[model samples]
Target: MSSKVPIFTLSNGVRMPSVGLGTWQMTGDEGKTVIRNAILAGYRHIDTATLYQNEDQIGDALAELFAEGVVKRDDLFITTKAFCHEVAPDVIEEALRNSLKRLRLDYVDLYLAHIPAATRECGSHRTDVKVEDIWKGLEKLYSLGLTKSIGVSNFNESQIERIVKIQKVPIHVSQLELHLYLPQKAHREICKKHSIIITAYATLGSPGRMSVIGADGKPLFESTKNIPNELNDKNVKALAQKYNKTPVQILLRATVDMGIVVIPKTTNPERMKENINLFDFSISKAEVNLLEAHERSKPERLFWWPNVSEHPEDPFAAER
Candidate 1:
């Protein structure tokens, strides 16, 4: 296998590994093992969020590694996000401090405003927080040096532009649901204009998750007539077979080629190693052209889109 890709430097001068282990569904002991193994496997970046409820497990693993002198705290790039309805200055500060406490770290490498919500509804978890107010609080955190870098998740072009205009500092990253099925191309242009790096989640189309608008609960990437549909387009599968790689690896290479960071969340050790093994291969221009041709195929949104009618903060409402 080729040498692992070096970490990417953020717009703020903070270096973050382009590939990392995402800890979304992982929980309890399973969460710790996934993180520790990923670290031992040579992953320096780890993605986590308060909503995951596994911060304490990550903390324990990091503590254990530190005690064993396996890795120094500065060597690892840790990222965590704070959800909407916690954008109040005090609440945001408290949430961040709590994250630091749970992760057993002095500060996080990167902290994101998980979702944009309104200030009045922040403490009540009302899910109506405004994006600008949240940006204000994030800027505060950046100024305080409590977070090495500050950014957003699930933000669109317009939302990102507004934040850039008002931010006291530049945004270093914007995490979004980007995959073979749903590539947010237009918004990516806006991010590029602001020098904001895009980090993709659900990089595999999240095959195991439920569809957002389907009542029958169709899988995000269902196959038809022995051919994979959605993100697993015949072309993608063909490329995967040609390279002796999984469709997931193809999707990841495509995103990485676009200069976007990918984090495919999985607790399975083999899969974790498989997901990060892409540095050894490179996709050709012709292959990327074939994948682009299928880009207009039906797009799928996997995660929750709660009360879209009521929540303007909802990212799913943003145009793809």
Candidate 2:
């Protein structure tokens, strides 16, 4: 059969693999093994964030990959985020240089601003400057050939449009929270219009990580009408049976079918291998509709808000 995965070319002409490995909570010596496993399992792209504090481990895996000659430097598309204190111009370059040193590479495939928050919190690792300053720094880095592509994460439509108006360079990607619950259809459309590709994080709603509490302090899953009470919702379960896969697999496949890129974080080797097996199957249109009906208008935000209260234009704060 032909490859069903669709890869969109960025404005810069970089070919990003639609399905890549996401390393969020996975860190330390264990990350090296997991990353190596992902590469061996056919993942050509790897997404890491400076905030994740695991670049050293990812770097170790890259070194091994280089030594073994399994993947050449240009063959792999490695993406790293510049967040926290690195949002300033000089600091951004310094951070990229640090990330490069950690990964033992000359240039990164894509570098993203982890969050669109213009200022750092009272006590946060982020910088107190605006994103536009960071964008200028990123553009300069691109011109210097330190990075092949530059982009942002968690940026809203207005923020992105503002950047587009002033950007001397085009953004190649916008990494955000996207899943069966948080469809982000409008955001996806805006990115498409600007030729900005989106990379999805929290694809599974982070089942292993505890869900945020609601206004009553109860788990959001308990009160949120959007999420099914249990992972084994009837539609998801039935589809799982039909596909001969798990509910998670069905969800990932559905996301991919919608022409989006997803990076589900998993430390378990077995689950990592299972997640990549998504390439082996397809979900039917009828099944996709069934899944769509389960889509929650306000899915519980697994990644929380106290960190976002600093941003003046948070969409979810007012709606949910």
Candidate 3:
């Protein structure tokens, strides 16, 4: 199709695969198998964060793949993010090195600050650290070749602009909670102006969000049960029927059509295949716009960081 998925080029000319595997709760031997299967199923990009606590397993999966000659480290685009505790300028590089140790990689293709909020301890928010300092630390990592590209996750428009204004190294990507309901038009525009690519984390089926255990052995976020599932939306259903694809497929393809990268997570091998098989059909520009506009009207948000929501530096502080 004319709208087939294409690799997104970062401002620095790094080619990132449009579709990636999101490893949130994927862990243990099972998680390793799922990661391995996803790679075999055609996903070249893998996203993980130190907060996820699954880097070791992912590293094991990749190591096995490399030893088998099924895939080389150079063939895949691996991304990992440092948690808030490591956001401090002095701690960022050391934290990433530990993550690199766990991931069994010499360097990551992309590295991100998990959140804008800085903390001495992972959960205890600190008001003293500057966002610009974090950017400098990320820039240093890029210079040292610990990460090929640097970026941020869950940063607000203002926080992003402040960094952009002072950035010695451009923010190559921004990871955000983007879905049909929260299409993030404003954030997209800002990133577009700075040539920063965005990686949208899937919120397609967020029912168990509140119960997701964080590294501290507690629920990660508040409940998302109130928001209607996009897969159940009538418009999404209609689109699926018209395209002879599933509702999940329609949502994924429409997002890619909007020029944003998507990382959909799944432990089920069958669903993993379904998520990556989005290139065969093209959702027309008119349809994509309508789809985004339709679901956005209701504007439901599926995830909320209750832990850091009240922190002074939190971008989503108003949402509380």
lDDT of 1: 0.78
lDDT of 2 by residue, 1-320 (tens): 01334565688898877777898767788999989888777777889988888999999998998899988887788899887556667678888999999988999999998876544424353434566777898899899898899998887777788889889999889988776666787888899899888888878776644544656777754433345433467877888898799988888888777667878777777887778778677788877777767766565455644455645444345544
* C-alpha lDDT of all candidate models, in order: 0.78, 0.77, 0.86
TM-score of 3: 0.94
TM-score of structure candidate 2: 0.86
Give candidate 3's root-mean-square deviation (CA, Å): 2.6
Candidate 2, after superposition: displacement of residue 260 in Å?
0.9
Please tell me which predicted candidate would have the highest lDDT against the true structure: 3
Q: Candidate 1, residues 61-178: lDDT per residue as tens digits? A: 9999999998898888899998654665557988898999999999898999887654343233444356777888888888888899998987767788887777788889999987
For all predictions, the C-alpha RMSD in Å is 3.9, 4.0, 2.6
| Candidate 3 global CA lDDT score | 0.86
Comparison by lDDT, 2 against 3, better one: 3
